[model samples]
Target: MIIDNGKLNKQQRKAVETTEGPVLVLSGAGTGKTRVITDRIVYILENNLAQPWQILTLTFTNKAAYKISKEISISDTSFKILNSKELWMGTFHSICLRILRRNFEHIGLKQNFLIFGEDDQKSVLKHVITNLGLDIKEYNPFVWVDKISFEKDKGIQDKYSNKELNFDKIYTAYNAQLARLNGLDFGDLIIKVLELFQIAPDILEKYQKQFKYIMVDEFQDTNAAQMQLLQKLTGNNFNICCVGDDDQSIYS
Candidate 1:
């Protein structure tokens, strides 16, 4: 298949066109990872290998997704997946929010659920701790939230699912409060999605079979929630593509 050579470097070209299982484009900075990504996607579509709906692509940042869109828009000499009017790109969070919202009712959530940022999360945690007879000051609700969130990121459920968690009462209370408020933080989004997948197998099966190809950016920075999501979504033989630079993982 032909690609606009002026748009992509050698590494990007190879990684993009490689239709293998869990392809990882590993390199340091300035390696045209984005170029390869767009070209690869275009080639896949142009070659009639996959459709727009069958492909699931994610970038680390919305800016990155925007850049990919701009580059692909410029290289119009190649194939196009969506119409020129369409934009099927964004960060992991954006993609998951769409998926979660659409399948919310299956998991006991509202379609218009609000996503709580850090401040909202802390506020809710504060109240949950108070209700559970815990001192928010001594335990530090903010610090507790961050630490507890780390475990959730690692695919570890709180007392709600895993009984051995020391802060089970607090975590359970925190989740209860979030549900009452019709809100979820970034960590809750991942954790709830995981929870939904576990509780609602039918919903998971529908999505798992829908996207034939899954592309993930920044593989090295993948948290437990992301890894587990990928694991649950992709079959042993499904096409999975990941691009990342390992040394760039700074702690949250």
Candidate 2:
């Protein structure tokens, strides 16, 4: 648990040491933000604040997740005392997928439900559009995919009532098609987890109690759905840390 304080600047040292409550560290590019996150994790482990499985670290991309996981694994040789692989660390979608895989049946989805990629989702949308007697040229599946994703991210439940394009009809039909195939698009990963939590408070409570500490990288890029998911998981225990820079936010 011995850390050489000389290696870390005063601010980084403080971030690494302060592990009791919600902490926010805002830093610009190349300021060693990742190092701070990994070191903080190391600090928690070294101090036995929480077990590896009780810690959840999330990033936006698979690459970033892998990078952080690897950094934590190599941060200190003492990390060998616990299996870092047991840590709940991954991209938002990947983490959600894990949760959904376990409790999807609660949301009326089978355990083996398929997860459709963008191309597969578009194909399904195209089929729905054609079956609804809409012109493919007029209702571009690509555009609709983005529109649907945007709506889902915002947690919009009401069907589109606008008559100009029958967006409501298309939206419903598209979802129906996905259900008929027992599949879900990328957007459904986060949305369905949120839905599962809402319908099953007991299940949500289990996770809230399980994950004692949570950390999010690239917090500025999180959408509404992602924010809600974080809120629910951290509702019971507010021990969380977020590191991001407003200037580097691409989603905003």
Clashes of each: 0, 0
Taking all chains together, each candidate's TM-score versus the true structure is 0.87, 0.93
What TM-score does candidate 1 reach?
Answer: 0.87
State the lDDT of candidate 2 residue by residue for 23-98, as single tens digits: 9999998897777778877788888998888889998888887887777665554657446688898988899999
TM-score of decoy 2: 0.93
Q: After superposition, how far is residue 137 of candidate 1 from its true place, in Å?
A: 2.0
Worst 10 residues of 2 by lDDT: 155-164
Which number leads on TM-score? 2
What is candidate 1's CA lDDT for residue 49? 80
What are the RMSDs of all candidates, in order? 3.0, 2.1
